[model samples]
Every structure is written in C-alpha cells, then in structure tokens.
Target: MSELIGRLIQPRQPAFWFMVVLNALSMVLAWLAQKPELTLTVSLLIAAFALGNAALGAFFAWQLIRRPAK
Candidate 1:
C-alpha cells in the first residue's frame, strides 16, 4: 500500500495524466449522484468517495507539478 501510494505520487507521464483525469471524472460522477432515491447513508458514501478522489487528484497533481524538470 505504501509502495502503491509512493508510485502514485511519482509522475508517470501519460499514465499519470490519465489517472488524474479519470479520478476527476469519477469524482464528478460521484458528486452528481447525490440526488433523488438514494438514502442519506448512500449519498454520504458517494460524497465521501468523491471527496477522497478529489483529494487524491489534488495530491497527484501537486506532486506531478512539484517534480523537478527532467
């Protein structure tokens, strides 16, 4: 788990960008799902996931940009 996170924090060119975009899109979808038939627990779960993904995306983006030019 530590290794996976360490890897995530390190840029991987196209793959890293793709992961960022994917997480962004997923977060958007989760945010959008907070409506209608879902119960409070379900909605909260979705929101939690959205927030988590958002944090992850921010972290990865920061790390990617923070990386020194190669």
Candidate 2:
C-alpha cells in the first residue's frame, strides 16, 4: 500500500540505505580478495550494522507515527 511505502521512504531512511550500500560494497571487495577470515568478519559486521539500522528506522517511524498531528 502507499502508506507502507511512505513509511519506508521517509526522509531519515536514506541513512539506512547508504549504510546498506556501503556494506554491500565492502562485502564485494572482501569477496574479491578471496580471504575467508576477512570475508567472514566483514559479513558479521554488516549483519550487525543492518540490524542496528533497522532498529533505528523502526524507532524513527514509531516516533513519527506517534507525533500529534499539526
């Protein structure tokens, strides 16, 4: 629905998208290097970052939803 789309594409959401892109690029570079240990480490870090970003976005959405209407 349009409402769900609005919630996802809100102004503050760009930071999360940026983080995702950066992590994805790092993952690709790590993969290209062919180092198992480094790849694993980067993967774990990206997972953590993703979780954090999700939490942050959820918190922001909740705040936006709860704000009294103008």
Candidate 3:
C-alpha cells in the first residue's frame, strides 16, 4: 500500500511535475477568462495565453517521455 501511494504521488521527473503545476494554473486562468461578453482584444490575449501554455506543456511532456542516453 505504501509503495502504491508513493508511486501515485511521485513524479517521474521534477521538471515534469513543475510543468504539470504550471499547466493546471494556466487552465484555471483560461477558465476564468472564458467570457462571451469580453472584447476582441481581451479574448485574443486570453486565447494566446492558453495556446502558449498548452504548447509549453506539450514540449515539456515530450522531453520527459523521450529517454536520454545511458
């Protein structure tokens, strides 16, 4: 049971875990900004932020998944 718990909480890499946190925060920010009445400029800015977050998350995840040389 302890082993299982540890595995669940432990991240494979520290950088990946940090990215996960950042991604979560970005998602929350995007959610908060999701408003139909917002002006085009604000909406565009929010969209850009969201896209940048997603791209960074993807890149970090990719780097984590790719095995490095021995």
Supply the global lDDT for candidate 2: 0.55
Q: What is the number of residue pairs that collide in model 2?
A: 0
Q: Per-residue lDDT tens digits of candidate 3, residues 1-70?
A: 6543343343766756866876886787588568888887887888788778878876766665553412
lDDT of each: 0.68, 0.55, 0.68
TM value for model 3: 0.65
Off by over 4 Å in 2: 1-38
Off by over 4 Å in 1: 1-15
RMSD of each: 7.8, 5.9, 5.4
**lDDT per residue (tens digit) for residues 1-70 in model 2:** 6565555454555544654565566555445445565566676676666556556656655654444322
Worst 10 residues of 2 by lDDT: 61-70
What would the per-residue lDDT of candidate 1 be over residues 1-70, giving only the tens digit for each residue?
6554555554556647766786977667696767788888888877887777777777666665555433
Deviation in Å, model 1, residue 68 alpha carbon: 3.3
lDDT, residue 44, model 1: 82
Q: How does model 1 score by TM-score? A: 0.60
